[model samples]
Target: MGERVLIALGGNAMTAADGSASPDDQRRAVEGAMRHVTALITAGHQVTLTHGNGPQVGNLLLKNQIAADVVPPVPLDWCGAQTQATIGALVLNALEGRAAVVVTRTLVDPGDPAFQDPVKPIGRYFTEEQAGHFEKLGQTWRRFDRGWRRVVASPEPLEILDAPAVEALVAAGFTVVAAGGGGVPVARDDAGRLVGVEAVIDKDLAAAMLARAVNATVLVIATDVPQAVVGFGTADARPIGSITAAELRVLQAAGHFAGGSMGPKVEAVLRFVEQGGDRAVITSLEDIGAAVNGAAGTVVHR
Candidate 1:
């Protein structure tokens, strides 16, 4: 029998490891990723896709900075919405026009504590001196292993506003793509109006929420790695296979995952499984089909 599957793609799905960002490169990447998706579809699973937009949005922000004098820079929410359209288009086209793309919106709390502590990194990297200058100008910047970059608030996604549209499309037998870049983070105003907010929400977390909203039986988080590892850097490092959600949570609390990378993915999977999802899998995009069947990747279940 077919299952409703929600696949959350990591940023690498839209770009190459070679750092190629040209239009052709992006299309080619999406085409490559969609091959796996099509395989699942052919096998009878109803699949919906969501992807990260870090690199694409960062490039847009860089362009805004370089062309600031001639043109007014676009806001963060706008940049996110743009990527949703752009990447969603690529995914739809790659599926040979068989899918629907929803320019979705996610509701967040304006009072989310993440706003007070900006920690989600975005845009181009800067040197220590450059970061210092930006800090003095009241911008939040953080240094990563790569370099210093501007950090923005990443709020929790309370609701996927367009989830009904997604469900409708799926019920009509359409492969749906929604919630790119966490659905353009929005919050309600005093008058109960939905307004875009200058914030980013974690794509994996949003994917889990969407999966639950649509009553999806499986959530697949596709990343660059074939599977998540414990003791990731050392000799004892080993890939995690099928495990109960309770066991995974213990490892997460033991600090096996890094906050920036695998941590969010693990958290997202745990949330889905603990909150009524039958199971969730974390795997590389290339092995998504096998992962879905419990033949590959790190499978987590209740």
Candidate 2:
């Protein structure tokens, strides 16, 4: 029997750091990533895919700013739409049989404290001068180790509105692609109608929610790093292979992960496993094939 798998693709899995964000470049990147997906499919595993739109959306944001004088700026929700369409189409092109990109909406607390102080960075890294320029336009920026970056609200996801569609797609033997930029952050009104928010959602958390909702057995988080590690970025840093979710939670509380990066991935995987997933993986873009085969990368289990 085939196991259901939900793959949360990190940006680096689809695009390279030195690569430009042209359509051709992105297509090439998607094709490469899909090779791993194809492998999983051949191995008789049902697959659903989600990806981070940090770079793609960042490029769109750049276009928004560059054309601000001539055209009204596009809303964050619309930018998410553009990325979902673009990336979804790219992946669906590589996938055989029927597939569809469901525009996902995730419910979040409208009063979430993240809105008061935005911390999620999207788009390209900017120099101090560029960051200052955006700040003057009433935008927010924070200095990262990679340099200054634009900050936006990243509220925790409460629910995935399109989860049923994802489940249906997989049931129909369709490769489902959804939840770009954390499912176009939205919240419900008093009457229960969804109201779109101007924010980006954490991709990993969103993917984990999708996994649990669809009852996927495996959740694969492919990132730039090889796997979760201890003392990251230091000479004494060490890779963590298979670990129980309980022990991983202890290590997380010990501060072995950084908030902006590995921390969220660890938290997301732990949630997946604790919620009854058989396995969760954290691995590099290049190792996705091996990671899924249990030959490489970090694995988290209950």
Candidate that scores best on lDDT: 1
Q: Which stretches of candidate 1 lie over 4 Å from their true place?
A: 127-139, 142-148
Worst 10 residues of 2 by lDDT: 12-21
When summed lDDT is taken over every stretch of 10 residues in candidate 1, the lowest stretch is 130-139
lDDT of 2 at 219: 91
User: Candidate 2 — number of clashing residue pairs?
Assistant: 1
For model 1, how does the per-residue alpha-carbon lDDT over 157-199 read when each residue is reduced to its tens digit?
Answer: 9999999999999899999999998888999999999888889
Relative to the true structure, how large is the alpha-carbon lDDT of every model? 0.91, 0.86
Predicted model with the maximum TM-score: 1
Task: Give the per-residue lDDT of model 2 (tens digit) for 1-302.
Answer: 76888899988756756756777788888988888888888888888899988778888899987887788777788888788888998898988657778988888998899989998778788799988977887788999999998888989899998999888887898889989878988887889888788899989999999999988888999887888998888999999998899999999999999998898899999999998889999998777777776677899987
Model 2: lDDT of residue 174: 84
Model 1 CA lDDT for position 2: 83
